[model samples]
Target: MIDDDAVGGTRSQTDVVIGGIKQMLTSGALVPGSRLPIEKDLATQLGVSRGSLREGVRALATLGVLETRQGDGTYVTALDPGNLLSPLGFLADLQQPAHAADLLAVRRILETESVALAATRLSETELAELEAILAAVDDSLQADAEMDLESFIDADTRFHRTIARASGNPPLAAVIDTLVGRTFRARLWRAISHRGSVRETQAEHRAILDELVRRDSERARIRMAVHLLGVEEFSAAHADEDPEAS
Candidate 1:
């Protein structure tokens, strides 16, 4: 269903801005490759102020509509998947860093019980995969200085994905993957990564693996929960020390 905001604005300003943009888009005046007029010019044309015009343009950009270039002008970006999806990462890297551990806490609550039980019911083949992931994690840890941020992140992600996959629930793992995703590497590297971060995280993973290997679902679940909670506590303390968050 189309949103009310998409059409039938309650106010004249919204109506003028939205209606004008839609008109230009539907008409050939602003084709896919065409450059948007300057903000002042657009405001004049749309019978709105520059601020409102810019706001409307940003809203459309959020919906994968426009692209702004540095020193160059704003143009209608290609609506291809690559162009459209480029905003996801940039949005993820928004200048204001959120309390990451709080987000991780929610993820832990969602995944702990499920992953633990999944580990208990894992098949021999699945166990082999988990073993392989641990091996890779260890390999990366041993070469920590040589490994780039992405490499370390990939190894760690594989470790988590292995446990999530063993849970036998695709949707659960996918959600977990998205939550503790690519942005997590940047956060973890900055916050928790001292010289000993890898060793500390490796030890934590080992403890989690020990409980899972013994099929102690309760202990495994609690262990993972505590680990994620530790991250929350760490981040909170870090925020306390930072003037920005305070």
Candidate 2:
């Protein structure tokens, strides 16, 4: 019985319902963990059909802004910007090969700043942990004559994540975390397919770590930028040759 016009009307109503909920959040009338009014009552209040209201609620839930409990109710989430924005990882994963360079450019911008901040803010214990991570990376490299791609990638991710955490900004760390997650798979593939890249990347990581340990914020920032840019260049070159690799 649902015609095209009916579907269009429902979509519009869904948007209105979404807007109303956003406004409530903005006005602080609906804080984190606040249970929404029952579905029927909320639909009536928003002057929307239950179907439209449900669609909007489902969308919000998917974005991590809301959570629904069976037999309980939907409630606003903790509203952590990090949680809400995690879907960016999916977008990053879906990016076409042509967009690889663009993604790396963003990583360079964020990670340069993060490394600079980490140089100044990282404590002795944190520095020690980073050293251990790199040491493990080295050990993994020696584990096999060829190269242990999986182990290296794990250590690589841990190294960057530790630095991000050391930067002392939760939001920035969260963003960098997502970017790293999105790109690490491609990075691993690039390393596996290209000879000498593994060693080169390990050297670069060591240099960046040295700068961080020296507490030279500017040097750490520059080294980090250079390291990421090298990866970007490698990806660009290979992507042109094999557009379907990643």
Candidate 3:
């Protein structure tokens, strides 16, 4: 639960400015791409000192709610999900390895549904594009005795990103991308320490593509679940072995 003072109760002058701006935003008085009132005007309106209002504006700017231009005044941002939810990646990065399973579990729930949606939505051209991405993965796998880890990870990111975007939900795709990107270090460690992981991942990707090709949402969902679950289990089993986990 959030602290009572944090949500309500006695507040600081900066909080007043933040709350005032939030009220404007929620009541449709302020909108995306709209310029904010000048600092003196806004400070007077909010009944706060200019310093407090400036601090509040800085806080919102950090949260992707507003932006300041060089010559132009401050303006509301487009409020894109990718920008709004970027902090999720920061939180994910702070999780200890013990919490990796929990993080991946959430991802599994979101991405299974994402893939199911993508199955029916992906265009023929998009399907071919996904195939090409997998072919790149194959090339990375066969590149040398030591797999080209950078190339392989790049392909892995693209494969999941393509499917997530094809789900036709920008917010969902953004969340999935945040989760996937944060877990990438763990995935890299798994591939390096566990032989045959590359091959196993390759097979799983093929299975998902097959289901997508058939436009079978349920089967695609199941395949995606199994694939993510494997990662969760692997992380749980090997967390102690990962120096990065510490």
Candidate 4:
């Protein structure tokens, strides 16, 4: 329980409630999956009204720090990277298409390093899987027919995501996944407006995968950077293009 004197400082009651719970967490009084104390008792312990405590709890729930079961009670969450960073995708989705260049810039920095790591860490089976993804891309591009936008996009998403996961870094992979999901519409818009853009991107994916297969970390990083930089430049040039329309 929080100290009685923990509340009633210059801070708002909600802050007090939040801070008290934080203190309990840090002091090992709480752990992942620990059930919170009863509402009235916790309210009294924090020296705050039950309403204020509820407000604080709601805020924590939004942040993925806690979960309230339908009839069981509130408890601490596992606090994994996916849970904590889940809000990032939601926020990124709300940004204007004009901001895609900004998002891609960040993506480039993270993915370049991730690909470098993946060059050394990926398994033989994973390498074969990547080749298969690009093989599908090749088939998609070989025909004179109009591109299947959804098929191309799915392949594009899987290729990069496989590399990110192979980097052997869970948190990094989670963040890259979020960024990739957010940038989907911008990529689709580019493919629609820029003739042969899909072919260009597919070629770049081949280059990156080739470097990874060779286990050349430096070249893999370079290839990945160059690939994303092209997308960033294209997105930046068309700042007014609303990808949502595609």
Candidate 5:
């Protein structure tokens, strides 16, 4: 039910230009991470104005179909559905409180299954990666270096992603990747609100790692669920706290 006429797609020229771009992405003429022709060149080739070309690119970028580098040219993003799942994640974050919990429930379902699978299938390399991530978590917690919200969240994400990777399915890893996009950043911000939460997360992370190292998948999965549930509990308990407070 898209009204092409409403979204800068009214003109015949605009429609043709958008159609061609869609065809290119769909037909694989433009692959992920591949740079597109320069804007002027693409505009000329598609018989559209440079402004229109930029508009199209901006739209695609918003959809995670493309990424624009400030000093460099634009390129297609990894077309993995997981890569494009951020919008849904963002929407979920803004949804009703109950809906947010629902999303978390779905995440728990996926991750619990993954941890069980990982126990049966992880390769030595994958196991080592998990250990490495755990080591990084320890280092980050112990470091005197000031970790900003972004660094903390990235490190936290790497921790979970390593576990997902150890689960031995790229698709499962991707699912967790998508699931984290919404709330992981907020969780870091929440942790920064209370000094104690940071210490708590670090201790909990070690416990989860210990469970994994013991090759007890059930314990690992349960620990992970408890860890996340603790966050949910703590966040709920401090709903009125300032997320930006140091």
Candidate 6:
């Protein structure tokens, strides 16, 4: 079909431009912060039309590989792992509610590793900070029937975020940050609907924190994994109970 041919031609041209830029980067001819040659010049160099080159540049920009400065030119980004992996969060966010468990599974894997690293790396001050967060969480729990769901959720998120930062790996922390945001609404709903779950989750947090304080990396990892698994199970069981909840 003519439309198919047109689509194929566009794809081919984009691929050519992408390949050309990649070659330049790999060869160190286009290092981070290096401005791309003017579009016309670059198109001529790659033997591609300007339109194709622009499309390739836009794609790379979306992936955080390139940045277009206003009134300036496109340049290579710092190419940090966090920046490059950020697009993964966008994709994860797009997943259907039926796939919530899949996202939790991934979070479990990453957060388990992060907790393990934090167990060994967290300083005494950081441990104290975590303890303080747990204390606030407990206070909220003790409020019982009067518990503020939003307050407890805030403390819960801060607890996890603190541990993620203690892991000393920005990329891991960044991924966890995205996952936490994506699941926030679901988690809040769960806590509001099932008040008993708040106590259980706080207990799990205490156990995980104890392991971290003892510098028991393996136990911390296991505790984190177990805690996340419980959350995933709860979410899965109740996902079908309310189709519009998430």
Backbone clashes in each candidate structure, one number apiece? 0, 0, 0, 0, 0, 0
Worst 10 residues of 4 by lDDT: 185-194
Off by more than 4 A, model 6: 1-10, 143-146, 182-192
Candidate 5 whole-model C-alpha lDDT, 0 to 1: 0.69
Best by TM-score: 3
User: Cα miss at 55, model 4 (Å)?
Assistant: 2.0
- Please provide, for model 1 over 5-109, each residue's C-alpha lDDT reduced to its tens digit, 9 standing for 90 to 100: 534655555456766876787886787878988877878777776777777777777757777787887777665544354454443344244565566666778
Best by lDDT: 4
List runs of model 3 lying over 4 Å from the truth.
1-9, 143-145, 182-193, 243-246
**How do these models rank on lDDT, best leading?**
4, 3, 2, 6, 5, 1
> Which digits, one per residue and each the tens of the lDDT, describe model 3 over residues 113-176?
9999999999998899899999877776677645665566677788989999999999999999
Better structure of 3 and 5 per TM-score: 3
Report model 5's TM-score to 2 decimal places: 0.58
lDDT of each: 0.67, 0.81, 0.83, 0.84, 0.69, 0.80
Let me know the TM-score candidate 1 reaches against the reference structure.
Answer: 0.56
Q: Per-candidate TM vs. native? A: 0.56, 0.86, 0.89, 0.86, 0.58, 0.82
Inter-residue clash pairs, candidate 5: none
Candidate 4 clashes between residue pairs 3 or more apart in a chain or in different chains? none
By TM-score, the candidates rank as 3, 2, 4, 6, 5, 1
Write the residue-wise lDDT of candidate 4 on 1-246 in tens digits.
Answer: 454444336677888888888988999999999999999999998888999999999999998998999899999999777778877886567667678789889999999999999999999999999999999878767774457777777788889889999999989998988866735544545534445678888889999988998999999999999998988888788778766554
Model 5, 155-216: lDDT tens digits are 66777777777887777777777766637456535544455555566677778777776778
Better of 1 and 3 by lDDT: 3
Task: List the pairs of residues colliding in candidate 1.
Answer: none
